[model samples]
Target: MIISASTVKDTSENVEKFVRRNLLGGIDHLVIFLDAPLPDVEELLDGHPDVTCVRAHGAWWGSTPPGGLNERQITNAALISRLVVGFVWAEWMFMLDGDEVARIDRPVLDALAPQQRAVRLLPLEAASRLHPVADPTLFKRLLSADELQLLHALGVIAEPKQRSYFRGHMSGKPGLRPSADLALGVHHVVDTGTGDRVDTVKDPGLRVLHYESHDGEEFVRKWTALLSSGLDVAQHKKRAPVAASVAALLSLGLPEEQTASLLEELYERTALDDVESLTRLGLLVEVHPDEGPRRPRPPDDEVAQLRELLRRAADVNKRMFKPRARNQRAPALIAKLQRGLR
Candidate 1:
């Protein structure tokens, strides 16, 4: 299976660790699309034979509609999907967030039949009491004993549980067939040609372990960063008022108030004691490790070619959409006028 992800500077360490763990888990290739420029991206991948890094320059948040949903996260997934469809050779591709990992019970390809256009993996949220860690291996070790939680059913609507806490808990992410003309959303996929939902298989064993938040401080920092990122003007406008209220509360040193009112309102705090619940139900179990041979590194020239493609894509994006000064003439027109005068 092929793995794809998009990331920024703050999440680089987590992304690296995620890739390493996946490689060890027998994933054949990894393609990382960086939304922001990270100078040490290649070094972080450590020249892994099966990894390719692409630096994206376009405005990733442009396509998302104004809502509470994080445009950056959604657009990042879409960008990775676009790239995978354009370049990846794998039949099965899994797109993941920097803080998410997929636990596969069987070989990823073997788990999903060839006829399936996509597969949905249920999400298992992880809880931590300490600050967010940089090492994935260490984080996994910590979470080995840490409690796991799932969103509680708020009510019953037409026989379906109305759970609105985590956005992705109900509709899981699509493990796509890259060859198909599919348009990826945050937690779903649609056919690009027909504009219809793709045929998907639900795999009970393929689960996503999400490190949603590490602690109260981390949660605040995450929200603050999201508010400041300027990815969605509407989202920013909507959050600015709540953030002002939260800031006032923080200045008064009323952290408990902030956690109860602001944090709880934004994220789900219902502790279902999922680890124990799943254990008692005989549902939560570990996946078997795949002991496959180490993958061979791509040819040096192939890596060079991929780098060249990234460079060209960046240049084209800059030329097409880099902001211009007010009433400024187009660059191409200015260049042509200057050449004529010369």
Candidate 2:
């Protein structure tokens, strides 16, 4: 059976969507750990079939958290990994974030050969919308190293670092076979007892819909929270280049309005501005995420001050994201992308 776990603190709308999508995608069970107590979200999930809600603040962490985002996620996932393997007796466990949904339409582990102990589902990051709304219709996939180099060389991607390929994580999360020899991780698995990283094979039939930053507001919330928090961004080693930039941004300590405006500018610049160009080069994938049950998606729900601030700031200086007109250089760029992938 395929089970999934997440450590989350998000608006109920996002959480509810995550639940409905996973349910429709055929996940056998879902366990959510609320990093902070979210009564609205928890109540929304209460008594739901095949879903277990665990509060992370209470006895889960001895009544005090480790004071960092990564620790909280890793702690909760490790605990759940033990529970699933030792007591729940599940065959496979997937670690997902609240913004991510697994699209498991076909048999995954069930169809895998016995020797494939670990697997990874590539991520399709949600594309940004011109208006401040989630673009559930379009998502972008990561490029192979060759494609990335070509894009950088052709000046299609302004930033030559890893972040240019995809704004969020490209190291996709893991789906693992439970065993005493392995330990669960935030992104991948490790050899238990040895603390060594274990390798994973890419699963061909599975994909994770990663809404890492659903909109301009979400982009502000995520980056602002990180910059404001005293935690070291370097903790995410794979994102060191990103971390360096974040560190530089943090050093500025600009006023909230200035920071928000600058962030939105950056978002507009880096986000999907030319969908047609990427699509023509076979880089973009269009997908209509499963609209979970017909119930309302909790758009009008109340959230804490942080989310409210993001919404207002993002709205105050709103800008439309019209795609740039195709230029003569577009054809050559597409040719470079296609030819390099070979």
Give the winner by TM-score. Answer: 2
Q: Tens-digit lDDT track for model 2 on 157-228?
A: 875665776778988888777664565678878765556777887865788889876577777666666655
RMSD of 2: 16.6
Local accuracy of candidate 1 as per-residue lDDT tens digits, 119-208:
876665553343335311212211121132222332211122223223224355567775425645556666655556676777656666
Quote each prediction's TM-score: 0.60, 0.74
- Pick by lDDT: which candidate is best? 2
Off by over 4 Å in 2: 63-67, 86-89, 130-134, 159-162, 228-231, 237-259, 270-273, 291-342
Worst 10 residues of 2 by lDDT: 315-324
Q: Report backbone clashes per prediction.
A: 0, 0
